[model samples]
Target chain A: MELTRRDALAALAAVGATVGGGVLAGRYDPPRADAASDAGSGSAAEPTLSTDLLDLLDAAAEVVYPSGVDGRRTFVETYVLGRTENQPAYREGLQEAAAQLDAVARDWRGQPYADLDADVRDKLLRDLGVETAEPVADGTITERIRFYVVNDLLFAFYSSPTGGRLVGIENPIGHPGGIESYQRASMSPSSAERSGGTNER
Target chain B: MSADGGSGGSDGGVGDGIDRTPSPSADVCVVGSGPAGALVAHRLADEGANVVVLEAGPRFEFSERTAQQEQHIRPGMEDPWEMGGPRDAYSTEGRHYPLNAARVKGVGGSTLHWQGMVMRLHERDFEMQTRYGVGTDWPIDYDDLRPYYADAERAFGVAGAMDNPYAPPREEPFPLPAFPPSYSDSLFAEACERLEIDMHSVPNARNSEPYDDRAPCLGYGTCKPVCPSGAKYTAESHVAKAEAAGARVIDRVPVQRLEHDDAGETIEAAVYATPDGTEHRQTAGQFVLACGGVENARLLLLSASEQHPDGLANSSGAVGRFFMDHLFAGAGGRLDEPTRQNHVGFNTSETHQFYDDTEPVEGLKLEFLNYAGPSPVIEALGADTWGDELAEQLNESYGTHVAVGGLVEQLPDAENRITLDPDRRDDHGNPVPHVEWSLGERTERAIRRANEIQHAILGELGASIEWTVGPESTGPAYHQMGTTRMGSDPGQSVVDADCRTHDLSNLWVVGSSVFPTGGAMNPTLTIAALSLRTAEALSASLSDP
Candidate 1:
């Protein structure tokens, strides 16, 4: 529904292709369970998250998802770099977006965004209306910068195949199916009142 | 030719035929490995008839790529992103559609992506001319095909709801009980009852339990485009059965034409082309065309010769005429609250209360869309929400989404036909099928009624309108039927009641192509039943004194 990592991974799969009796696709197959579990393991050769722009984005990610900051950063770097692998034009655009994000952070905190205190960082996001959920477009430069960080960067981490596991969807796109069966409580008022995931609306 | 050539232990073929010549002879040769072809082949081979099945596409050896299948063919996604195959290679010479016809080219055929909706056309659907005075009557009635339907259900391992007076009359119960419906199904049933409508479990050719050595549905919720689990029935299961029963199935060999006798009343051999530009002829006592509607008609049209200047089976000029597809339509809207419907075994229930209502030839089944969820909504609307707030919103609204719709029956018109493209060619250098079709006045009228009903049903479920889609964008090409229609008379039909072409005693047409009218039901089950019936007739004819 949210164009999750499954949808992106789906783009790489073709029916005719096979390798050693295994399908050529499955960026998240069961064999890759080890890779997903260790999403934080990065090497020096990975240049995607090396930019200062990514550093600031990673700081924001750290505040939002403090428990798995390294994993989130790794997942984001991998997804972004994977998407921009073929298009130099799009890659450059992302780099430019990072520079713009830095500019916005400088104006807001009187310093580079990543260097701001945690309180200042939180207040800056709240003040810029970055906490809003609906997609915003045709906006101010600051508004666009806020969107890039909160929506693009944060979403890429949580929406990745590993990120889906962080939530509750066990068989997100690219992953092997066969989760143990269990009934989920409905999002009705009675269930919502009894449990927590669903709201009373 | 004897099925075993009288040496019947296990190797069931003419042992020296392969060593002698390239032409292989069989008791029956079938074109198209879809439902009709696979079922007929399986049944005939089991009946001790040597059968050869020629499929025009690859067998899709990559079975484990569920995501690719999900993206390419799952029945109702927002214009499924295809994996690019010959299935989606045909051209439309006539109308505008938001999506191309969801055709699956392989041994399993379109069934590889079907939703497993196994429903029977009502009794009145077979006698539309006598009942509603709208469409041509089927050569045979429901009673004639009823036994075959039951047989097909058992053969296909269908899980169905039985003992309902509302369901089509049957002598026996379902092979397996119905798959449990989702939360939305219950809500929709309540709404339907409140609105004074009857809803029933959709009879589907899917396994609710493990049977036939195949695993039950794992509830992956991808029934269209592809069923990752074997829970849902694809024609490949029958193809495998046919092969196991000694039917020789050759993939990637597109049949070119039928070699007819000088009188043009008997098919002697079927010539086909392999992928490597090699041509071979299979001499058979009988030939069955189960290549779906368009391809069947297209093949017949391609077999034009001096004796039959128009086409091989075009004496009635009906080989490619009367092309029809179920006029598909639906409506979707948001509910007042989350319905807890999305993400459970999707496409679990349907209601046929209004089937055979306005037009005897037409019927409509209402489906409670389990595919409705936040992700589809976001993707459909291109809502680029990415932050934590959006994620929370998605989790909150995951299940509340709802929609309802169904197939509306279409009246057959000769103008809506499949003719060969004069210039365009496929892999074998044969003219590709060119279809000219659109929703007729009757079908559009039916859609309006269906659209209104959907609104009332959703309204009864406390739905508040949020971007509703109606039948305007509905693509009817998904259910290709009625191209090579069967009838009682030779002057007006391509095939007889037994599904044999009137012009050629040994030539037969099966599948939806033989339907005189499409009755707003998914036609795979009916196609299977008819093919089985035809296989029986062919076997009987072959063994005649």
Candidate 2:
């Protein structure tokens, strides 16, 4: 089905279970350039992502976190910029990531930045992530972006409507049970051992 | 020093009429503004008392400080301990059960970042000394505090299953119904029942539905930071309520030394410092020292005068003794089936069998904790030190596993104490409280047994045990308590059963500092109940006079 933004959000909310009956529909929208510009005023000019890179990031996010019934993607465009400037290490990491991608792309097609097909892009990205590229050094420019993207994707997904629902993020305030035996067990050694017999199921 | 015309001049005329002095004066002076202090001030002000709560730390607000949150979540700033601002946090003296908890100084106190788990202590907890013979009994039993617990529950708008057969009896139903369990909780519940371990949903103080004008929890997963939605109950909420009630809460003022008259044994005034370092005095008809456990005792120790050399109200020499904290440990294993519910919410379902279990420890209760899925940093820490095994485990368990942990009671030990540092002082030049703690053999035994129980429970549930140990890399459980205990005899305790200092009739101490023993469960609910009881007593005293 072709999902409208409303349908997408509803599906996402159903998936996340975060939007209860009280959620005001259409209240949230992607921030306008005015708001974004205001928030980023003091920082250097905002860096523009090449359409190819954006496509690559979206494709990667889909593979890592497949779209749920909500049909909405988990990659928030803001995350790319948010981490880049507010996070210095992330900026350097992104540049190094671009370099790695270049290396992978070269090995396959000998073409530079702008000319790559969807199939070539997917193969190059997947190979780099799997076994082709050498392991990135810890905290290096290349390593940081890879970590940041993965972490951001995971965080956004889990916290999002669909991800939240799939994982079961309940309303903490209305939760019905008293102190759980498991929680109590987790806190004590003797009880933990006694209760250890039950966790396997 | 004879004040109030009472006749008891023993101890070198310390209470002689010769030193009688009028009580300090203040429009509204609150002693300890933890949950109780905040509530009382709010209620009294709502009744129109000019309330001024005395806290030892600078006034703090979650939104006002961004440094800690910014640094912790920022890509490279991933240090676990580096989340909060320096002055905004407290550290334990060593790796012990009395682990130092992060308490906020500004408006809300520790509630600003609390998990908002508000469960009433079972009725048996009040009579532990009598029933279990392993600990001292409370001056007032659960029955006495039941009404107050209800009031606090109403005030905070707790959500939980009132019908839970295992729960304590309540005169009134919860202000709100229970919140739904997350997916993870349901899975755990199913797994637990299969193994015959009892598990239930967790009760929380966060709003299930809007109560008292507060919004419902937004589920931001950033509760450890300030709740932007203000759904979590903090002293700040009470501060606002108290202000509306006509109470005045002066922020950024830290109480230093409390002055008591040597002759009459009555508090004269409290000496304190403002954010700017200027010294000031607040006198009231009565004075309460609600400045948390460590700070409360420190104030008394700092207020030593010729009349009471050991420190004001320290005749029994037990002012800074009997420290206690819950001992924490856990055993968890990988389940054969993917518990795909791991990421549903923060903790939801938990085991409760250990709470009233007759086996093992006769007197202690055990509480289970379902900490949300492991953070990436924690996941990395657990990964194999040398191989891609760490990465593989991280991938497998990242969002598809569930683990249960434990919170065990650490019985109080007199030798475990909080005392003044010989050569250390805070930024205000005030002596800082130092804690000296060592677990008694009973606690060690409890840990050994609990670990075994956890292993068995998980194994029965068809899970492979991965890690089983006590607090990782952190010393002692951080729920610090038992510094200033209450008892009937002045020879053995600092405060009386009423939480009043035996030596100084008008000087009352509140907070967990007055707890003689630290139970295994979280102390916030009990502490709130006790604070309310004290406030009731104070209110009566004020009205009668």
In model 1 chain B, the worst 10-residue window by lDDT is B11-20
lDDT of 2 at B311: 85
Model 2 vs truth, CA RMSD:
11.5
User: lDDT (0-100) at residue B265 of candidate 2?
Assistant: 85
lDDT values for all models: 0.66, 0.56
RMSD of 1: 9.6
Candidate 1 predicts chain B with a TM-score of: 0.90
True contacts kept of each: 0.03, 0.01
Docking class of 1: incorrect
lDDT for each residue of candidate 1 in A1-201, tens digit (9 for 90 to 100): 223334333222212111221222222221121342368553323222223545665667655542423345444444444544444554454554455555556655657667887667666666666554332333554445444455444434433333443333433322223322212334222222344544433
Poorly placed runs, candidate 1 (over 4 Å): A1-201, B1-23, B70-89, B97-100, B359-361, B373-397, B467-471
Model 2, runs deviating above 4 Å:
A1-201, B1-27, B56-100, B188-196, B262-264, B341-346, B357-359, B362-372, B375-395, B470-477
